[model samples]
Structure formats: C-alpha cells, structure tokens
Target: MNNELIEKGYRRYVGNKIDVYFNTNICQHSGNCVRGNHAIFNLSRKPWIVPDNATLEEVKRVIDTCPSGALQYQEK
Candidate 1:
C-alpha cells in the first residue's frame, strides 16, 4: 500500500504483481476503468479494483485512460 496515496484518501487493493489505488473523490465516473477491463475493475466485486485479475500492462493501459487521475498502480 502507498502511504502517500492513502494519506491522500486513496484506497489500496493488493495484488500479486501490482497494487491498484483509487480515490473515489477524484474519480470522474468516466467508466474507462471498468470498460477497459471488467475482470479487473468490476463494480459488483467487493473490491472494485483487482490488479491480479489482469496483466500489469493491461492494468497500466486502462489506468492511462483515467482522465481524473483517480486510479493509480504501483509495482510490487
């Protein structure tokens, strides 16, 4: 988990290869994260962001579409 992101109100979702971070307040609700990869960003899931569900490249690719900068990833 990222101390800076958490301190900034971003929640952490732990994964095997990477960790996903999200700040709901910063999200624009653009649906880019979910649309990019449902397996990783399913809203129905207990944890909306599942980094291990997809490849690191895939996760990064989708996060790039987040105009709000709400979603972030860090390498393990």
Candidate 2:
C-alpha cells in the first residue's frame, strides 16, 4: 500500500502522474496553467489543478510551463 498510489487514485484517469503537494503560501498567481487551458487550471476554483478537466498529458505540458516548482508531477 503506497500512499502515493492512494493520492493518485483520487485523480485517476486524469493524469499519468500526480502532484503530491504544493505550497501556495509563497506562490504568485502566475496563471501559467490557466493561461493555456482555463478548463484545467482556474485560479477562481478550488483544488486549482483539475486533472479530471483535462488529459494527464495536457496537464504535464502546462505544468512544465510553470516558472516555479510550485507545480510538480510524479508517476504513481
């Protein structure tokens, strides 16, 4: 029983990998995720990154655009 697998289960079918945790306290609302696809990441919404909204591959592409490591992805 891997905790990482459990967390990823919460958002299964969304992405190939998952972003475990992110500290937004020092994060600046860069809007990198939303800029490309509002359907995926919306600052106005809760749990900002909506894996269910878009395919995992799409999410990965946007995540790479993040200037800050504030966004991360790990395989389950």
Candidate 3:
C-alpha cells in the first residue's frame, strides 16, 4: 500500500497487477477518468474503480489524464 497516498486522503483500490488511488478531495471532476474507461471508473458501479477491468497500460494512460492529480496508481 502507498502510505503517502493514503496519508494524502486517497482511497486505495487494489488489483491483481495494479493498484488505483483516488483522492476525492482533490478531484476536479474533469471527467477524464470516466471518459477514459467506463468499465474501470464507472460511477454507477460499487467501488467504482476496478483496476483489473482495464489493461495496465490503459489504467496508467487514464490516470495520467487526471488534471487535478486526484488519481494515482502503482503497478504491482
């Protein structure tokens, strides 16, 4: 687990090959995340972020688009 991200108020979403972190406090709701991959970041779903729902590259690519730095990830 990323202690720094957790300390910064980002919730962790663990996956088999990757981990996603989201800080709602810092999120600007740019829609980049949901738009990038609904299967991975669908708000209608419980525990919205499912890293394994998308490919690792896709996950990283989308996370990079977070303008607010609300999204972060670590490759397992």
Candidate 1, residues 1-76: lDDT per residue as tens digits? 6899999999999989898899999999999999999999999989778889988899989999999999998988
How far residue 30's Cα lies from its native spot in candidate 2, in Å, is: 2.1
**Candidate 3 residue lDDT tens string, 1-76:** 9999999999999999999999999999999999999989999998999999989999999999999999999988
Q: How close is candidate 3 to the true structure, as a TM-score?
A: 0.97
Give lDDT per model, in order.
0.92, 0.61, 0.95
Report the number of the highest-lDDT candidate: 3
lDDT of model 2 at position 38: 86
lDDT of 3 at 20: 98
lDDT for model 1, on a 0 to 1 scale?
A: 0.92
Rank order (by TM-score, best first): 3, 1, 2
Clashes of each: 0, 0, 0
Q: How does candidate 3 score on lDDT?
A: 0.95
Error of 1 at 71 (Å): 0.3
Candidate 1: which stretches are off by over 4 Å? none
User: In candidate 2, which residue ranges exceed 4 Å CA deviation?
Assistant: 1-17
Better of 1 and 2 by lDDT: 1
Error of 2 at 39 (Å): 1.4
